[model samples]
Target: MIGTSISRWSMTYFAMALAWLLAALVMMVAGIGYPAADLATPNTLVLVHVVCIGWLSLAMCGALFQFVPVLVAKPLFSEKWELPALALLSAGLVLLLAGFLSLGGRLPPALWLLPLGAVMLVGGFGLVVVDLGLTAWLRPAGPARFVLVGLASLCATAAFGAVFAFALAGCAGSAGEVILAEGIPLHAVAGLGGWLTLTAMGVSYRLLAMFMLSPDVDDQQSRWTLAAGAFAVAVTVAGGALAVGFASGLNVVLSISAILGLASAVLYGRDISGMFRLRKRRHLELNMRMATLSFASLAGTGLLGIALVSIDAFTEQIGAFAFLAIFGWLSGLVLAKLYKIVAFLTWLETYGPVMGRAPTPRVQDLVAEGRATKWFVIYYAAVWIGTVTLLIAEPNTFRIAAVAMIVGVVGIAREIVRIRRLADVAGPQRLPIGTVMPHLLYANP
Candidate 1:
């Protein structure tokens, strides 16, 4: 399904990614030879929103629009929502980013738009959540439940983000302080660890099987892995909150929950790797390649946490930890998948009707992979370099890394636009077989 609505999702994700990249570029130029701030600057904060909500969230939404229908054997509840959602999301992101940049400077009143836009953006997510949730419940099987859990995590993420948004607006009081101290961190944990990561796992389960040409892995092991993973996220997140609020035996509770979380990770790793080992296809596709890297990053982050904790280095290098989890692992997977997805979508809309009977186009025909490979390489390289640079507190290095990311962003945007044009063509090639098709359409085909 990652590759199903390839064009629509591609256009969405790339547009967002490009926005994020531009934001990053702005910060890079503005902060040149300046000290890297403690937390992300207003500029960087805006970029963060653009990346997480604008880029990633939109990508997921577009994919679900196409994926859910196939899973349930029904079209979307409303195609009309698509264009509106896209426009609202894009505009909201712009306003939100503008607000953050303004807040960075003199904390202007215009920053109000940030929250206003955020509300609209969240509304967009809410629409998707309600629609997807209803559909998920209707079928109530396959990967939909995992999708539901992921959606639940996303809701939690948005609520927590709203708290941060309020904080940005200077509206936070004692309640806001409490959330930042306790609720905010927990929100991030649930958002990234629970929402994004869980969704990735759930999607990977179905997608890995499809790309590998294997039978559906709807078995006890698969069920347990997913269930245990979700349970671990709930318990750990709740326990962390209780520990923070009550201020009693917090360390012990957290430690125990950490172990459970680790165990769940181990189980999921085993299951996903087993899928790869038992793969029916001899070679991996681009999506699987990126997905494998994601799993590896996920496991590696867990191991790194263990190391940091063992050596009492956790407090000192916490920023590095966040960087690896979010940028290194999660961003890597997203970028990789985006490459394949855009091309896949382009093929579908432009070419799917002609797939079965004729000498149909292979998925690879949509993009010249050689041209795209450098960006992927550079992006990941920047992630690792940036991680080390952040570790050592070097501004110049950080700027260079940021620049590299921007370059990668431009590359991605170019591909996305290319795909969109291909998808927009309506012609005989797009028409179904055995029809007295319009002659005008045949020329393009």
Candidate 2:
């Protein structure tokens, strides 16, 4: 039995998120965003929000809507409401991009769009937080604990983002200027560190174990890792507030948060490694294998961040760090898992009802991992190439690498859509052409 109910809206969210990702990638190819333009410019801001809010945030929230119920063993407070939240988020993102364009002279001065879009975003996020937050709180066990902290971080991220919007719109006067100057880092910290990274970790903890047939990550270790991460986000948000409000003690608080965050990363690395070492499955699947690459990228982000901060060159190197964090670590991990998640969910939805009376394909039968693996390899390789090119100030090389990345994304997208359509699975062969063979006609892997 598929133990948890399927989230009807999740696939819709994933589709929109992937569309945004493709749009952003196209922008990269056209040299419209960062690495192509100045980092703080309006064009770059547009691209950043496209990737962050439209793609990453949507995808993560969608996954949470589906999985949080599984983790907490409860139905969503209201599954019907998720579609409205997605709509609000989508509309808000459009307005946010329009506001950014207005600043770039691409749109006629719609400065009000900044706060207006932010308000919509806040509402969208608030709905999600309330729904999932209530569920996680009702049953704070295992990954649910990590998810709860992550939801809190989402609130902080949205709040900071809203303040930034109002400030940039010139509503807060000098205070607005101060927030723009000092709060950007905090906004990033809460959004990336707390909402995205922490939540990804929490979700992955349960997912990796389930997919690999491994024992859950040790409860004690999981607690320590998430606790430290949660505290780091808490401190970072606190630091942002002080900086915005009192303009004092911000640095000290950030330093402490940095230490806590590093500790969390270290502990998390240890825990995940142990999970791999102890797994009952001797041969890891493609998604797990791809996740290893993302985990490596995360470690690289940590090392690079430390090196930059220690030398006080973090500001100069911020673009490269953001690139690695967004594309390599976050995007890579999400795409890798979606390959499995979409298929698994499809299998459950399609086959779970008649599991025993009629023959049904294995979830693996829904995927063609060998074909998809090369796309993953291409994507990650392109990400590194793009990251290095950006670090070295080689925009031309980065653009070329972006083209390669597009090709990779398109290939992966095709595979995902094929699975969704059930385009390949049929007949007495039992499995799809790309899957295992009992019949003489199936393709060899």
Candidate 3:
């Protein structure tokens, strides 16, 4: 059964990650971090790390533990390491945040925690990467290839982040300055574009087709999209490294990378459109409907990146672009997918075993869709409004929008918790023969 294949500790990690996300949003809304602060300030840095490392990375790792087996048709290499990895990552993130907070003062003890935290975080991620890599390698598939590459990118991103930690702690020499100057942008690109976005693309390629009852997308267009995206990320990383090691011709290389990235983004958009057109499900679920916004935001972010580079306005536009890419695209997609995934996983855990023995509610029956839909709508709307206000340099409007987004997030979180406790509401209901499950209603398209 699917439940047997699922990892035991994944939900624990997911719950913690969601809490971190909500906390970060609350901090932003209260003017204690992010939108109210300059991009280079410690408060902004703290917010970025919390969202990227504490929230997104943790969530994605938990998902990988649960879904990689489904994608590659094999079990995970080691579920035993999940708890240790979680402990290390959680402790490391706390230390890292503390280090950033104490940067304003000459606290050597706090500064020392930066590298220590880096080690723990990298070690935690390393263990998962090895486990997942081995599992993917056992039965290589198209989607597995993307996931492997993404894991490599995650390692590279973490390595660069470690260097940045030491540099920020005043431990790196002149070389550190060069890395600080050139590597920061590269770090963001690799983490957001290469690791997170690429991984999401690969996972979506499989999940979307399955959930929508669409045919497998093993076409030439899909291969081209993957190839183009890989090339774009490689060139961007190489160019950034070269700029840091040898301070010459930064503009030319960055421009080329930007153009290639734009091309990759176009190909990805086309691929997604093709998937939707081929889908057999006439009425899309709320999660799929919300996912469209994320796809659009990704395309918009790419176009904005290209424009910013072309006009030599990278410095001025980086903050807004980062916001759109992180909050508007990545976080938005995660929330949308979680709307379905949480209920699906909860069903597998609570009801999968008793399916034939007794009557059980369908996965969709666990969700309160009428109540949850408005939360997603409000969240995405607030995100767009906040992004626009930030771009226009209006702090007050952005804070107001952030508050609305926080409320939306809290609402969705509440719904997810309710879904987990479904037995309290519906108890058990019997269904007659030939009854179809809501999630699999379009299974035979």
Candidate 4:
């Protein structure tokens, strides 16, 4: 038997995340956010939070709920909490988005929703942290340690985010002002660099090796990457807090943290490259091929970030850097991985029980990679063009690129839907579940 039952809520989370991503793409194509306007504006904030929380965070959580058990060879501590967490997160995100819309001159009284939503989001993620933390504690694998660190960073990120929301609501007075000015950078760094990036790195270490049929990669370079990443996050958070609190030596502290972060990026890249070289699989799949672009984007983003900070050009380039990091690197990786993961999980759920009793198709049979590869190419190419145009201050060109990205996202979304509905073509008898209900709608497949 599989080590644990598939996470009942995983597909729901994936569906919701993809929906949010599509919405964000539409908004981008409409020129409602960055590259067309100021990055710090309310609309931009709405777009950022929508993508970060609704899309990326939800996807990551769902993956953990499924994969953590696999990694540990133990069932989740409790599957019961999964749906409630998802509910809370979804409701909170809607409220938060509404609050952002209000700040952009919608319902002014709805401003209070910001903190309210933040609290609920924190509560939701807190439950996930508890469940995953306990699971990791029981297993205590090396990768699990990185996950634990990532979960800790997520808590900090949420807490800081809530405070930032309060600051936005004018509830924190002078301290809020200081936090708004000095703490935002730390908040971004911790959430993006520490929480998201570290977790992705940790998960990728396991996934890349497994998918590529590589030798176990729990080596010195991987350890150093994890340690350096953790250290960089620690310094950034502690140094940022102290600088904000004491109002002294902020620049120096930030500089050191940035340097450490860059070092970690280099180590991580080198480690992943080593894994690729050691892989027994000579033919790389589309997912792995696209994943390479994400890795390259990470390296490029790191170099740009370090350069911008060194020359004090951060303010000017922060918009472009965030674009490259979030959309180009992180989002690209998520989408690419999903192409394989969703298919694998779907196959497992649908076919695992009947494998020996009946002839069944392979997991790779579920996805038509030849068709899917085009969408990946379009997505990455558009992202590349969009990033370049944005960096060059070419709004019109960026808007055109954003439209291409929207088309690519729509295409990928269609492909995912098609995969989920494969039971129709494979014949209803092949489905483990009796009904023809949407795969993502039910807790059970």
Q: List TM-score per model, in order.
A: 0.83, 0.94, 0.92, 0.94
> Any idea what lDDT model 4 has?
0.83
How far residue 386's Cα lies from its native spot in candidate 3, in Å, is: 0.3
Give one digit per residue, the lDDT tens place, for model 3 in 95-181.
888888888452445788888898899999998899888998887677777788788889889889898888987888788867977
- The all-Cα superposition gives candidate 4 an RMSD in Å to the true structure of 2.2
CA shift of 274, model 4, Å: 1.5
Where does candidate 4 clash, by residue pair?
none
- Model 3 clashing-pair count: 0
Give the Cα lDDT of each candidate: 0.65, 0.86, 0.80, 0.83
lDDT of 1 at 13: 42
Candidate 1 residue-wise lDDT, 1-445, digit = tens: 4333322333544555556556655565467212355445665566556556765666677667656666665556665566667767778777777787677774566868767777877877777777777767777566776788888878877776776677677677767666655665566666776777767666666666766876666567767766766775676567766776675544665566567667767877888778878888987765566567666777777887898899998767766677777766777777667666566655555555555665544566555566767776676677677767876878788778878877876786676565545433334443345322222111112
Q: What's the ranking of the predictions by TM-score, best on top?
A: 4, 2, 3, 1
Model 3 CA lDDT for position 261: 66
Q: Model 1 scores what on Cα lDDT?
A: 0.65
Model 3 lDDT, full chain set: 0.80
